[model samples]
Target: MTEFVLVPGLFTGQAVWRDTAGKLAAEGARVQVVDVGPVRDLEAHIARVVAAIDTIAEGQDIVLVGHDYGVYPAVGAADRRAHRVARIVYLDTGPVQDGAVALAAVPDQELRERLAEDGDMKGELPVPSREEWSRWGSTAGVSGEALDRLTAHASPQPLGTLLRPLRLTGAGDGLPTTGVLCAESGATIDTVRMLLRFGDPTMKALVRPDVTFFELPTGHWPMLSCPDELADVLLRAAAGEGTRLEAVGEEEAGEEEAGESGYLRPFLLDVPEIPRERRGAIDLYVPEGGHVSEGTESGEPRPAIVFVHGGPVPEDARPTPRDWPTLIGYARLAASRGAIGVTLDHRLHAVTAYPTAAEDVAAAVAEVRADPRVDADRIALWFFSGGGPLTAPWLAEAPPWLRCLAASYPIMAPLPNWGVNDSRFRPADVVAHGGTPPFVLIRVGREAPAVATTVAEFVGAAEAGGAPVEVIDVPGAPHAFEGLDHSDAARDAVGEAMGRVLGRLGLE
Candidate 1:
C-alpha cells in the first residue's frame, strides 16, 4: 500500500522530501514528493499536490499529509476529491479557516484579505511583517541556505487563491486528522499557536475527535528532524495500523512504481571545500531508456562529462537548474550514448552571479567523483558561455574534485552585484544551476576582452598554482553560438567537444 502523500508547505520544493522520502523508502512504504512548482502558493502549487492525492487515491483511502501552511492545500484537495480521500494529516499545520477570519491572518495596515472560503494560499497576502520571517511564519525554520534557495528560485504567487472561499464538497466528509506537531525548542509551540491563530472556527471551535495528535522534539521541518518517526507514522496510516490511518491498499510491494527518471541511471553529487560545509549537489539527468549495458571494459562505469548548458535561464527555470537544459537537446545527446553525463546548477551574477555559482561547481565535482555509477577519475567538466565561473574559482582554489574542465565564451569576470546570490552572498546556488561539471576545461569563446581576459587570468592562476587546466578559443564563435539548442552544429559540437576533453583525461 502507498504509505502517504506528504506535501511541503510554502517556499518548499521536492528537496523537502529528500530526507522524509528517504526514510519512508527504507521502511517499505511508497513515498513520493508531489511536484508542485518552483513557486509557492495555491492554484499552481497546491493544486499539484491535490491532483497527486486524487490520482493515487482513486476509489481508495489516502492520508493526505501536509506541513505548516501546506494544510490548506491538503484539506482543499481532500474536500474536492472526497471519494478517494480517506484522511488528511496536518503536520504542524493550521486547520481550515473560512471567511474574513482567514483574511484576518493577513496583518494589513489599511486592508484585509483571506482564502477562508476557497482555501487559497497564493491569493492571500501574508502582510509585510517579521512574522513572515519569524517562527510564527511557516517558513521560519528554514536554514539560511535553504532560504537562499527560495530567494534564488522562488516565484511570487497569485492573489486570487487568497481571496477565494474554501468551499468543501463531499470529498472531505470522512476525512480524519493526524497532527504531527513540532514541539522541540519551541517550534511545536509556535505551530500550535499558529494553528489556533489561523485555523477555521470549525477546527478551533472543537478539538478534533478523530485527530491522533503526536509531537516531535525537533525543529519546524520534521523531514529533517525525525525522518524515521515521521515515516513510521505515515506507514501506519497508509497500512491502517494507526488510530486515524487510511484504509490499506491491495497492491503488493514493488507493484507501485516511482516517477520516471528524466534518465535510466540518474545521479546526484554533493561536494564541498573547506568552510563551505558541503551542500553543493549535482544530478545526471536521464530519460527512460537512456542507458544500456554498463561499460564494456570489465567493470568500467563508462566515461562521464559534465554537460554545462548556456546562458541566463528563464525566471521559471534558471540556466543550470535541472529543468532549464531539459528543454534543450543537450542532456538528451549524452544519455543516448550510454554516457553518464552530468548537468549542474551554479551561481553567476547579472547572469547567476559569482561565488555562488563557483561554489556549486567546486562542490558538484566532489560529488560527481563519489557516484557509484561514475568512474571517479574519468569525469570531465564541460561549459559554454558565462560558463567561465565553473572553472575560474575552482582553478583558483583547486579544491581537488576535477580531472579536467572546459569552457566556451565565458563571461569570466566576477559580476558587480549578484544581490542575494552574490559571491558575497552564497555561491553554491550558481555553479550547479549554471551546469557545473568535473575535470579540466575546454575553454572556448571570442578572444575579446569580454571573454578572453577572465578565462586567461583564471587559468593562468590555476596553472601557476599547478592545477591541470586548458583553454581553447572558438575563433569567431559568438558568446553562446556553440551550445544553442536550435543549431545542430552546436548539438554535435557539445558532445564532440566534451569527448575531446574526456579523451585527454584518458576516459575515452
Candidate 2:
C-alpha cells in the first residue's frame, strides 16, 4: 500500500488536512499529516515532516505532498530522503530555487514589505482579514463555514519560515515530481509552458521527463474548498498520471525536423526588402519610391506603422527584439503595403522595466512622427507579447493622431505572479471604460490559458462598453503563430490583421 505524508501551509496546520486525509485513508491508502506545533523556523518544520517520514513502515511507498507554504519543508524533507520517497507532490506551488526565501516570491512589494516588518516585530505574521484573502489568492469556492473555521484555527506564521533561505542538495535531483495548479490562483499548465518558452533558466526543470502537472479549478487552498477533488488529484499524481510539458524546442523539432527555428520561421507572405534606414534605436523601412527630399519637404507624407516587440528580454540577449526575424518581417511587410515600417529597441529587458520601456515607445513614436517622409496625423502602433500592456494608456484615452492599435498574442493584463501593481499596464480595465481607437487583436487557439483569459476579458469588456474591437483569430495556432504556425490559416490571419491596421491609417 502507498503511504502519503500530508503537510499544511502557514496559519492552519493538521486540521486543514482533516477532510483530505480522511478521503485518502478511506480509499485504503496510509495517511499522515505533519504538525510542527508552534514552530518558529523552516528547519523545525522540515524536522517534523522528516520525523513523520521516519515513522512510515520501512520500504512502504511514500509520496510527500506539500500545500502552499508547506511545500518548502516537504521539499526539504524530500531532499533529505530522496531515495526512500517514491514521489513528491506540490499543491498550488512551483519549485523554489536554491537560496531563495519564501517571502521573496510574494508578488506585491508593499504587502511583502508590510509582512516582513510585522514578522520582524511580532516574531510571526498574523492572518489576514476575510476581505484581504483575495490578495493572497482567490477565495472562490471556499464555503462560509470553512472560512470561519480557517480564521478560528489560524495561527501566526513564524517570521523565520518566510525569511529563511531554502537549502537544497542534489540528493533529490531527477526525483519524480507532480505539480497541482489551482486555476483560480492564476497559474495553469499551459501558462507555465508559455513562460518557459522565454527560456527562463529557473523554470527549465519543469519541462523534464520526470516532472508532470495537474490543475484544479479552485482557489489557493484547495484542501479547504475542494478536498475530495484534491484527494483524487493526489491519488492520480502518486500513480504518475498527469500531463507532461514539452520543452521549447521539442514540439517544433517533432513537427518540422528540418525547418528553420520557430522564431526564424518564414513570414506568412513574401515581400521584397524595402529601403532601410537606421536612426538611433529605431529602424525605418520605406516603401519603394518613398523618400525624404533632403533640405525640402516631400510632396506626400506616407503613414507609418511602428512595431513594438515583446519582451522581458534578457539585457544580454543578442540581436535584441528589434532585430528578431518576426519583428523585421512585420516591419518590411508594412513597407511593402505602402506604409513605412518602423521598429525600435525598447528597454523592456525585465518585467519591472515596463515604465521605462513605455517611455522608449513614446519617444520612438515622437521620432517616427517627426520624420518629413511620415504622415504626422496618420500613425498606428502595433505591439507584440510583453509589449501588449503598453497599449493600455493609449486605449484609455486615444490621441486623435493614433489611428489604430494592434497586438499579436498580447498579454493584456499582468499575470498574478508578476507582481505588477501598476494600473497603467492593465489594458482590460481601461477598455472597460469605452472610448478607444479601433483594436486589432490577433488571437491564437493554443495561446497560454492566462494570456487567452486576459484577451477574452479585454474583448468582453470592450464589447460591454461598446468599444470597437476586431478579432482575427487563428484557431490552430500558438502564441507566436507568425513564426510557429506556417499554415494557410496563419498566413491569412497575419495578412488580414496587417491590412486592417494599414486601412485604418488610410493606406488601403
Candidate 3:
C-alpha cells in the first residue's frame, strides 16, 4: 500500500491533518501525520519530517503532503529521500526558493517587533487573538465551530522558522509534483509565479513543467473546510489525473484535454520601456487551432480585439499590475469565436494617470497591429471598468484600422477622488471630437445609481454627437456582472455585444 505523509502549517500541529487523514485512511491507504513539534527553525522541522519519512516501510511508495509553511520541510525531506519518494503534493503553497529568508515577510512589522520585544513564551510568536484569527482565517473558509476548534489548537510559531534561510539542491527534481492552489488566493499565487518567472532562480524550481496545477474553490485550509474534496484532490494528484476541479455547472460527459479549456489559451508578451519607469506586459489569448477566419477574403488575417484591464490604483497596490480574471474570461470568449484576444497591463493610476495610460494603450495597439497574424484593419478596443477613460483618445481620433470600441460597465466619467482631473478623461467630451469609431456600450441595468446615470449621460452625448453607438443593457446585472453571475442573461449579453462588434467589422 502507498504511504501518505501529512505535514501541517505554521503554528499548528498534526491535529490539523486529522480530517484529511481520516478520509485518506478510508481509501485503504496508510496515512502518517508527522507532528513537527515545537517549531524551532527550518532545520529542526526538516529533521522531524525526515525522521517520520524514515519510519515508513522500506521500498514502499511514499507521498509527502505539505500545507503552507510545512511545504519547505516536506520538500527538504523529499530531496533527501528522492529514491523513495513517489510524488510531492503541495497544498495551498508552493516550494520555497533556495537561500530565501522566509516564505513571505510578515505584513505587520510593528506587531512583529512587539512580539520580539516581549520575548514571551521563550521567543515563540504569540498565538493570535480570536479576532485576529477570524480576520486572517476567514479567507480559508474557517468559521463558527471550525474557527473555535482552530483557535483552541493554535500554537505560537517559532520565530526562527520565519527568519531562517533555505537552500535546496536538484536531488528531488525528478519527483512528480502537484500544486493544489486555493481559489481565493489564486491571484496572489499568480503574482508569485510572475515574480518567479521574471527572476529569482531559486523559486523557479516550484514551477516545473511536469507539475500539474489544480485550483480548489476554498480558502487556505482545505483540510478543515473541505476535507473530502481535499482527499479527492490528493488521490488524483497521486494518480496523475485532472488539473482542475470542475466549477459549478462545468461538469461534462467527456474528459478535457490538458491545458485545453473553453477559454483563451494565454501566451505572454512583454511590453518594455514603458513611461514613468513602469513596465507593461500582455497575455494574448489566441483561438484554439489558430485563428481561422470564416467567410473572409482568402489569405486575410483574422480580426483581433485588444482588451485593456481596469485599474489606475496606487503603484504599490500589488507587487505587479493586476490582470483581471473577468477580462481573461472575456478574452477566452473572444477566442472561442475566432478573434485574437489581447489583455494588457499598462501604467497604473497615481504614478502616471490619464495621458500616460492612453499612451500605453496606443503602444499596445501598435504592437498588436504590427503582428502579421492579425488583420490590422479589422481591430477593436475593449475597455472595462477603470480602463474606460483610456479609450477617450481612440474615440476622438480613431485610426483607420480601428473598426469599433466596446466598453463594459466602464467608468466613463472621472473620479476626483482618484486624482483624475484632466478634461480629456471624460468619454463624453472625447466623443464630442467626432470622427469616432462605432461604439458598443454594455451597461448593467441594476448597476450602482451613479454608474447607470453616467452611462446613460454618455450614451445621450455620443448619440447627439452623431457617433454610431449601440447600448446593450444586461438587465438586473451588477458591475462586472460576468464575474458576479454567469446566468444565461450574462452570457447572452456578452454574446450580443461580440456579435455587434464582429458584425460592424464585417467579420460576422
Candidate 4:
C-alpha cells in the first residue's frame, strides 16, 4: 500500500491535517500526519518529517504533502530522502530557496510591527482576530459549525520557524512535484510559473519545468474548508494524473476553455499606430452560455463597458488574462450581474507617455464596439487609478453613444512627482466642457490624504459645472482595499459601485 505523509502549516499541529488525512485514508491510502513539535529551527522540523518517512514499511510507495510554512521542511525531507519519496505535493505554498529566508517579513508594515510588539510578550505570533480573519482567513468557504471548529483549534505559531531559511543542495531537483494553489489568493499555477520565469526568488525554487500544477477555488485553509476536494486533488497528484506540462503561452488558452464560469473570452486588439512590441490585448466577460441581447423591445445586444486597469509603471501596466486578480474579479462580477465586461491593457510609461495609453484605450473601445455581440450605442467607460486621466477627452466632449463614466480612487489631476504635465493630463481642465457625461466615483476615505483632497476638488468642480456625478465613500478603507483586504465592506463597495453604473446604463 502507498503511504502519504502530511505536514501542517504555521500556527497548528497535526490537528490541521486530520480532516484531510481521514479523507485520504477513507479512499484506501495509508496516511500519516506528522507533528512538527516545538519548531525551534528549520533543521528541527525537517528531522520530524524525515523520521515519519523512516517509519513507513520498507518497499512501500511514499507521497509527501506540505501546507504553507510546512512546505520548507517537507521539501527538505524530500531532498534528504529522495530515493524513498515517490511524489511531493505543496498546498497553497511554494518551496523556500537556499539563500532566501522563508519570509523576510510580513507584507503589510503595520501588521509586521504589531506582530513584533506581540512577539515580545509570548515569543510567538498570535493568530489574527475575527475581523482580520474575515478580511483574509475566512475565504476558505467554511462557515457555521466548521468555522467554530477552526477557531477552537487555531494556535500561535513559533517565530523560529518563520525566521530560519531553508538549505538545499539540489537533491530534490528531479523529484516529481505538484503544487495546488488557492484561487482566492489571486494566484494560479500558471501565474506562479510566469512569476518564476521573471526570476521571482520565492517562486523560483518551488516550481520546475516538470511540476504539475492544479488550482483550488477555495481560500488558504483548504483542509478545513473543503477537505474532500483537497483529498481528491492529492489522490490525483499521487497517481500522476489530472494535469500535464504545457508551454507557458498555451496555458491561458487552456484556462479559458476550462474556466470555472463559461463567461470568459480573450481578444487581441491591434494598435498599428503604436509599435507591435507595445500593443496590448483585452479580455471580454459575458454571461455564461453565450452573449445574449437584453433591454430592448426586440432584445438588442447587451451594452458593453470598457475597463481600463490602473498603472503608470511598466510592470503594473502590462496585461495578462491571469494576472491582476482583483480586476478579473471585478470583470467576473460585472458579467454575473448583467453587463458585458471588457478589460484591456495599454502601453506603459516606459514605452511612451500620456497620449499612447489614451490612443490604446480608444482602439480597444472601437474594437469592442465593433463586436456583433455588443450594443455599441450604449457603451460606458470605467477607469481605475492612473487610467483615470484617459477619461479627459470623453469628459470634455462626450460621444452621444457614451452613457456614463466611473472611476475608482482616480487621480483627477496631474502629479508633478509622476512626471505628469499639468497642461496635457489634467481632468480639471475639461470640467467645464458642455458635453460631459454623468459620472460615479468610488473613494476609500482612509487612502492617502492627497488623493481624497484631489477627488474632493474635482467633485466640487463637476458639481459647479452642473455635470451629474455620484461619489461613494468607504470610510476606514485604504486604497485598493478590495484586493488588499477582502472585507465585507470591500465587497459591498464594489457591488454598490457596479450597481450604480448598471442603473445609469439602463441595464439594471
Candidate 5:
C-alpha cells in the first residue's frame, strides 16, 4: 500500500482536504495531512512535513502532495527526503524557480499588491473576501457550503512562508512528478505544451519522462469543488498514469501526419512582397510604386497601420516576431491595400514587462507619426496574442490621431495565473470607458479556453458599454489561425479582418 502525505495551500487548513484524505484512507493508503497553519515560517512548515515523513515505516517510500502555495514547503521537504519519496504531486500549481518567494508567485497581481502593501515582511496575509476569491483563481463548481466551510477554517498565511525564498539544492531534480492542472484557473497541459514552443528552460524541464500531467475541468481548489474526482486523480498520479509532456519538436514528430511548425507556417493569403525599409527595431513596408499616390510632393501622406506582434516571445526566438511569416505577411498585405505597413520589436519579453513594452510601442508610434511618409492623423494599431493587453491604455482614452484598433485572437484580460495587475491592462474593463476608436476583434472558435473566456468577457463588456466593435467570428479556426490553420474559413476571416482595418484606417 502507498503511504500518502498532503499539504494545503494558503488560507486553507487540513480540514479543507478532509474528504479527499478520507477517500485516500479508505483505499487502504496510510494518509497524513500536514497542518502548516500553526507555523509562521517556511522552515517550520517544511519541518512539519518532514516530521510527517519520518513517521512512515522504515524503507516505505511515500507519495507527497502539495496544493497551491503549500507546494513551496512541500518541495523543500521533498528535497530533504528525496530518497524516501516515491512520487511528488503538484495540485493546481507549478514549480517555482530557486530563490523565488510565494508572494511574487501569487496568481492575482492586485491581490499580491494588497498583501504586500503593509510592507510587513514578518506579518501574515489575510484571506480574501468571497467575492474577491475569483481574483485568486476561478471558483467554478465550488459549492456554497464548501466555500463557507473553507472560509470558516481559513487562516492568515505567515508572511515568512510567502516572503522567504525557496532554495533548492537540485537534489530533487527529475523526481517522479505529477502535475494536476485546473483548467478553469488557466492552467492546462496544453498551455504547458504551448509554452514549451517558446523554449523556456522552466517549461523544458517538464518534458522528462517521470513528469506527468492531469487536468481537472474545475477551478483552483479542486479538493472542495470535486473531492471524489480529485482523490481519484491523486491515486492515479501516484501510480504514474497521467499524460507525459513532450518538448516542442518532439510533439510534432510523434504525430503521424505532421503539419508545418506553428511560426514557420505560411500566412493565409499569398501577397507580393513590397519595398522594405529597416529602421532600428522597426520595419517599414511601402506600397509598390514607392510613391504615396504621386501626391508625395504635396501635403497628402498615406495612412500607416502599425502591427504589434504578441509575446513574451523568447528573447532568443530566431527571426523574432517582426520577421515572422505572419507579421511580414500582414505588413505586406497592408501595403497591398495602399497603407504603409509598420512592424516593430517591442520589449514585451516577459509578462511583467508590459509597462516597458507599452513604452516601446509608444516611442515607436511617435517615431512613425513624425516620418513625412506617414499621416499622423490616420494611424491605426493592430495587436495580436499577448500584445492584446497593451491595447488597454489606448482604449481607455483614444487620441484624436488614433483612428482605430484591431486584435486577432488576442488575450483581452490577464489570465489568473499571469500575475498581471487587474487594475491596468484590462481591455475588457477599459473598453467600456467609451473614449475608444472603432475596434475590430477577429475571434477564433478553437482558442484556448482561458483565452476564449477573456475574449468573451471583452465582447460582453464592449456590448454593455456600447463600444463600437466589429467582431469577425471564425468558428472553424484556432488561435494563430493565420499561420496554423490553412482552411478557407481562416483565409476568408483574415481577408475580411484586413479589409475592415484598412477601412478604419481611411485607406478605403
Candidate 6:
C-alpha cells in the first residue's frame, strides 16, 4: 500500500541502492533510498531514515527493503513510521536480532559487527580497499571505480547503529515482511541456514503468516550482482506476491521440519516430561540420504553428532530457519563422510524451562541411538552457545550406553563474569554423569568461547584427575563463528571441525 523505500547497511549509503531503486521505480513502484548516515547513533540513524521516507511517502503505504546492516535502521524506521510502512523486503540481510543473542552472532555477520566493533565517525570500517571490493565483484561485473565512487559518496555510519537493539513493537506489528536472500554470499547464506545458530530473533518472530520469502543467486551485495532480480522480488512482494513455501504449516512446522534438506532428516518428537520440568519436546537433524550402515559383527550402527544449536530464539522449537547453516554442516560437510548430525531444541527459553531441555537431549540421543544405521558408541555432542550448561554436564556423566563425546563452547561455568550472555538464563537440570566418552572440543575464537573455557577448566580438572582432552581454536572469529552467518571462514572452519569430529567418532 505505502511506497517502497530502502535503508542501507553499514559502510555504504543510498548510493549502493541506485540500481535496485531504478528498477523498482521503472516497475511503477514509488521508491526511495534513505541516506540516514553521517549520524551519531542508531536512534539518530533511524530518525533520519524515517524523516526521508516520510518526505517521499507523503502519506502512503511503503514497502521497505533492507540490505545488511540496513536491517537495523529498517526496523527502527518501520517502528517509528509503521502506519506509512506496509511490508519489508529484507535482502541478503536476515532478520533484526533480539538484544544481543549471547554469542553476538559476529564475524560471520561481520559487516555489521566490524562496523560496530571497528567503526569511525565517518561510517568506515577496516574496509577492503576499493580495489579489493572491485576484485570481489569483478566476476559479477562490479568495478573498483564504481565501489570507490560509492564509498566516497557514502557518509559515515555511527557505532551505536550496529550495537543498538531493535525495538519493533508498534512499528513492526502486523506488518507483512518478505525475506529475500542471496545464495552466493557465503556469510549471507550461512546466516539464513544458521538462523538458530547465529541468534536471529528477527527471523524467529517473523515466521508467521505475516512474513513471505524469496531467494536470489546474488552475494551479500545484491544491488551489485543481481540488482534487477532483487528489485523484481521486492516489487512483486510489495504488490502482494509471496512464495508457496510459506503456505505449508502455519502453526507448528516443528523444529525438525525447519530447514529440511535432502541430506537432513528433521522430525519432531513428543518427549516425556521429567520431574522438575513441564511440557518438552526434542528436535532432531540426522544425515538421512545414505543407507543405514549394516553394522559389524557386533551389530552396532555408526555413532551420531548430537548438535545443540545456539540459544537465540526461545520459540524456534525446531530447525526451520536454523538449519540454513546446517546445509554445510550436515549435508555438504559432515554427512558426505557417512555421519549423522542431530540438532535439538533444549529448554533454553523460560517458557521452556530446565530438566525439560536436558530431557530433550537425553531422549534425542536415545532415539538416535536406537536407529539401526547409527553407531551409538561413537556419539558426540556438538553445542553452540547457552547449549553448554546442558551439554557440558551430559558429557561428564553420559549414560554408560553412550560412546565418545565432543562439544564446542558448552556453557557450564560462571555467568555474569565472562562478559558472555547470561541475561536470558533459563533454569535447567545439569546432568554430570561420569564415565563419559573421549572428549573432543572445537572452539572458534569469537563464537561462544565459554565452552572453550569450560573445556579448559575441564582439561585442568582432568589433568589433576589424569583425564585426556583435545581443544581446537579458530582465529579472528566471533562467538557464533561461521554458524553466525557472514564469515565464509567461520562457516568453512566449523564445517571442517564437524567433519573431523564425526570422522574421529567413526560417524564417518
- What would the TM-scores of all predictions be? 0.38, 0.83, 0.53, 0.54, 0.91, 0.50
Ten-residue region with minimum lDDT total, candidate 4: 268-277
Provide the overall lDDT of each model, using Cα atoms, as 2-decimal numbers. Answer: 0.48, 0.80, 0.67, 0.67, 0.82, 0.54
Error of 5 at 101 (Å): 1.8
Colliding pairs, model 5: none
Which prediction has the highest lDDT against the true structure? 5
From the highest lDDT down, the ranking of the candidates is 5, 2, 3, 4, 6, 1
Per-residue accuracy of model 6 over 1-508 as CA lDDT, tens digit each: 4477788765677778888888878877777778674576667877877887768635576777776667777777887777777787776554554353211222233243444555453443344555444322222334556556665765544555655566656646667888775544322232344443333564446556667777665445678666788888887787667653343332536432343221223211111221111113333433434433334223335566666654434454444323434332442334434555555555555312434666767776777777776666667766655455555555545565455555555444423112222222211212222244555566656433323445456556545544434556666654443333345555555556655675566444
- Candidate 1 regions with alpha-carbon error over 4 angstroms: 38-46, 57-60, 97-153, 184-209, 237-508
lDDT accuracy of residue 127 in candidate 1: 28
Ordered from best to worst TM-score, the candidate numbers read: 5, 2, 4, 3, 6, 1
How far out, in Å, is residue 417 in model 2? 3.3
The digit string of per-residue lDDT tens for model 3 on 294-409 reads: 67543467788888866544444343332444566667667666777777777755313667888878888888888786888889998976688787878777788899899988
Clashing pairs in 3: 99-166, 140-220, 264-332
Worst 10 residues of 3 by lDDT: 269-278
Whole-model lDDT for model 4 versus the true structure?
0.67
- What's the TM for model 5? 0.91
Off by over 4 Å in 5: 26-28, 58-61, 110-121, 247-261, 289-300
Candidate 1, residue 20: lDDT: 73
The positional error of residue 371 in candidate 5, measured at the CA in angstroms, is 2.1
Cα deviation at 178, candidate 6, in Å, is: 1.1
